[model samples]
Target: MNIILKNIKHISVNEGITINKLEQIIGASKGVLSRAIAKNTDIQTKWLVNIVKNYPQYSCEWLIKNEGEMIKPTGEIFLTKENIEETAINYKDLAESRKETIDSMKKEIMYLEEKIENLKKQNELL
Candidate 1:
């Protein structure tokens, strides 16, 4: 696994937060967030700063290199109303995105299923 993915996964697991939710809270798209989390790529400092600033619960060391715990030792996760409101708006946007992605994926799956069924039919005919 890429270091970014590993870090992202570790943070998500440790902090009890999803990548999508985090991305939403930070006002980044899912694709951008996914790319940023990849170890092979260099994540811009500004974006990383934005994420940490928005959610202090995330540890900089952990988010950067997957070395430390996602949460700080003190465990004082900031949950201010402003942060909540920002996160809430992102969640609202994510809700629609979630539905869209699911529908698209479902369509792709159906297409693959049809292709498999046709292949099976061809095999039976052979």
Candidate 2:
């Protein structure tokens, strides 16, 4: 079930950043964040993730639970383009490996099924 976000005012005030900068950091805009907070709008998980990731100092619980201090000054979340590209390449390689494994497993399953069917037919003849 989706829960409406609370304590947005507290978060904004504690962060000490203008709405625009906050939006930029989270890859959103002033209007979207403002509407969400002011109207008690449903916050998507993706948006929430972006916020928590970009501002690591901000308490994740505070962002989701609204039950604690807003900003905790945690680690940096910035990623360079090169880092992203490398990560993407790594993921592609992993996906290819997974696909190959799945294909092999499927073939093995088909072979086993065929053997089972043949054994059942032979037993019935006996």
Candidate 3:
């Protein structure tokens, strides 16, 4: 099993939730997680991000790197100086990745719009 999937399973089990329930909570399609878990395949980064967002009690470091305790202590903030620096770097990287995706999507939309315009012109001729 991928380490991330294994950790996710651990989180689900600890929280007394099933994989299907976890999927719903994370806004993933049904079997998205189950199939990945069953096949020991990697899941998308967005799902991982959603899981982190929804389950704040679990440590992102532990989910990604298995470096810390699975469940954070109650009322304890997970951030430290090192974590802050690392998170800043990660945030910048995520921002750049998202920007690239948005740019690609914009290009695709423009192409589709041009195609639609051409089709309309041809229809008018017909």
Candidate 4:
């Protein structure tokens, strides 16, 4: 079996979750993980990203390189200086994206409110 898949299986067992449940938690399609694990094939990087995002207690370095402890002590990620800088940039980008989404939603809400007000005025005239 591929080392990464092996580690993932170990994680599933450690967390007391079945493969199907892990797929659901990671938002992966049914059979995505199970099939790959069964076949010992590679999975996409996005699935690895989702796993890290969903299970923050696990060490990504360990998952990728198998160099560190599988689970992080104190539930905090052990990060190098470069990793810390990269994470800061990622957070900045994420914040900007969320702000744009919020602005767009606000505009949509305002437009809908105006439409409702217009409908109410038209009803009053009828």
Candidate 5:
């Protein structure tokens, strides 16, 4: 069997979800995945994306690159409103942190440019 098919089966088994349920979650027609696997044909990327969307606990890296564990070790994902609020706050914090880092880097770049100009002047004098 193709590695992709094997991986898909492995994911289904690991998730304790039947192939039929997987088809429903991914919105693929019944037996479509099985047919692709049996034929050893490549599964389309959109199908993979659907699977990822439906099963966020599964590692997309593993699905795509065959790297990392099939299931992510990250903490549980809850679809509750509290979790959503927390996630939004976390994202805002991350955006602020990244903006600060970019500003610092811009300052450093200006400092470096000034030093380079000074060095150029010294070289010209010599």
Candidate 6:
């Protein structure tokens, strides 16, 4: 089998799902991948991208080029108490920072939009 089909099979087995379920996860038709495998042609880029997006735990390099492991190294989760505490703190800090940034951006956008509206009115007056 081609690397593409092999990767798909690997993912299905790892995820404990069938080929049909894999198709569902990748948002593709049931027979599309099978046909591609039978023809031994390259799978389309869009399909590959969709699959990667849905299953970010899988290494894209491995999926397309067979260059790395199926599951990304960073995809592993550490559930130690220290790790959990650190993650919780980091998440809270990130959320607060993001909220502040988003609020500032909204204000800046509103200011720019008002300035644009004023410029439009001035042009109309001219």
lDDT of each: 0.70, 0.62, 0.82, 0.81, 0.74, 0.72
Per-residue lDDT of model 2, residues 30-115, tens digit only: 57776776676686678777766554556776666665666654454355675466446545645665677689999999999999
lDDT of 6 by residue, 1-126 (tens): 788778877876666555665565567888777677667777777788877665667888888779977777874633567556644654564566567768999999999999999999999999
The residue-by-residue lDDT of candidate 1 on 1-126, one tens digit each, is: 666556766655554557776676566777666665654566566667877777576778777777777677764666788878866765575576678878999999999999999999999999
How displaced is residue 59 in candidate 5, in Å? 1.1
Q: Which regions of candidate 3 are displaced past 4 Å?
A: 77-126
Q: What TM-score quantifies how close candidate 6 is to the native fold?
A: 0.53
Better of 1 and 6 by TM-score: 1
Query: TM-scores for all candidates?
Result: 0.54, 0.45, 0.58, 0.59, 0.56, 0.53
Task: Report per-prediction Cα RMSD to one decimal.
Answer: 5.2, 16.1, 11.2, 10.1, 15.7, 14.6
Better of 1 and 6 by lDDT: 6
The numbered model that scores best in lDDT is 3
- Between candidates 1 and 4, the one scoring higher on TM-score is 4
Better of 2 and 4 by TM-score: 4
Indicate whether candidate 3 or candidate 4 has the larger lDDT.
3
Clashing pairs in 3: none
Off by over 4 Å in 6: 75-126
The alpha-carbon lDDT assigned to residue 54 of candidate 4 equals 66
Best-performing candidate as measured by TM-score = 4
lDDT of 4 by residue, 1-126 (tens): 887898899888776567776787678999999999999899999999988876667888888878799998863865667556655654564566567768999999999999999999999999
Which pairs clash (backbone N, Cα, C closer than 3 Å) in model 4?
A: none
Residue 12 lDDT in candidate 5: 75
Clashing pairs in 1: 4-37
Residue 92, candidate 2: C-alpha displacement in angstroms: 34
Q: After superposition, how far is residue 40 of candidate 3 from its true place, in Å?
A: 1.1
State the local distance difference test value for candidate 2.
0.62
Ranking by TM-score: 4, 3, 5, 1, 6, 2
